[model samples]
Target: MGSSRWIRPEIYPLFAATGVAVGICIAQLVRNITGNPEVRVTKENRAAGILENFDEGRKYRENPVRKFVRGRAPEIMPSINDFFSKPDL
Candidate 1:
């Protein structure tokens, strides 16, 4: 029984883990083969994908807090460069 073959008792845990992973993969494959249905985005669910995507297009628009902080300065950041840039005056 002390003779070391291809499979060792010390490596049993690794074998078990590999078996579990293989089983999970096989389960996923079977599920895929059986046609796992996709979920459709609904308007009532407050679908985030489109809005989140389009929101990036609104990055130039000033936010309320930004408007409060910089007032008209936030709107002019991209166009005008030298404003009240004095360090000591």
Candidate 2:
């Protein structure tokens, strides 16, 4: 009687957590190099941008929940019909 499981059940969670940790580490490293918000906010040059980001986040967070949502997303919107139709512009 032999078991065919390549990965032991006891180690699965450990491996999964390790993988997640590694991925997060890699993501943070990339974000750091790419000037992510957290890293850039630490710099004096980014004061305005940091404030803008916070203001935007706050505005979004403070917005009241909508009873109903409308429209396709902007990119997907403005259909072929829109080409024939002129705006106020």
Candidate 3:
């Protein structure tokens, strides 16, 4: 019983190391099978996409904010103009 007890403690570390190695192998196999590599977004490709969209008939004035601000022009401009207009005596 004494020799068996001495051997059991030494085997725990070997079991733990084997478990870790198995986990790493499984993770690598999953990565290989999925064929999904990490996506790398560089500034050059992002800027090129944006430039292409802008070049392909996308104008700043066509933006929703510009349309909305222009839509509110009559509401805002008339108020300011009314305030600054000469008051009749």
Candidate 4:
């Protein structure tokens, strides 16, 4: 019991790693079954050429907040930038 207790702590990291690996494998398996299949350029697809007005090719519009920030420069401190940007007279 004493030796087993000592061994358990050392083996805990291995157990955790194995559990994580197993979980990832299970997740991938489930995703493969439920998710869309990978797109491949087959001979038939090549002959078909580019799809016109593809359903998935619709233009993506940003949300209001995202659009507002899109053109603006990222600043951690706008006040600091404003102060530094002014010409020293």
Candidate 4, 4-58: lDDT as tens digits? 8677777989999999999999986775544423332467755765556433332
Model 2 steric clash pairs:
none
TM-score of each: 0.36, 0.33, 0.32, 0.36
When 2 and 4 are scored with lDDT, the better candidate is: 4
Compared with the true structure, all predictions reach lDDT values of 0.58, 0.61, 0.60, 0.65
Better of 1 and 4 by lDDT: 4
> Considering TM-score, which of the candidate structures 1 and 2 is the better prediction for this target?
1
Q: Which ten-residue region of model 4 has the weakest summed lDDT?
A: 54-63
Ranking by lDDT: 4, 2, 3, 1
Candidate 2 vs 3: which has more TM-score: 2
Residue 30 of model 1 has an lDDT of 73
Return the top candidate by TM-score. Answer: 4
Error of 2 at 52 (Å): 19
| Candidate 2, 62-87: lDDT as tens digits | 43333233444444456766777767
| Model 1 spans > 4 angstroms off | 1-3, 37-89
Residue pairs of candidate 4 with colliding backbone atoms = none
Candidate 2, lDDT over the whole model: 0.61
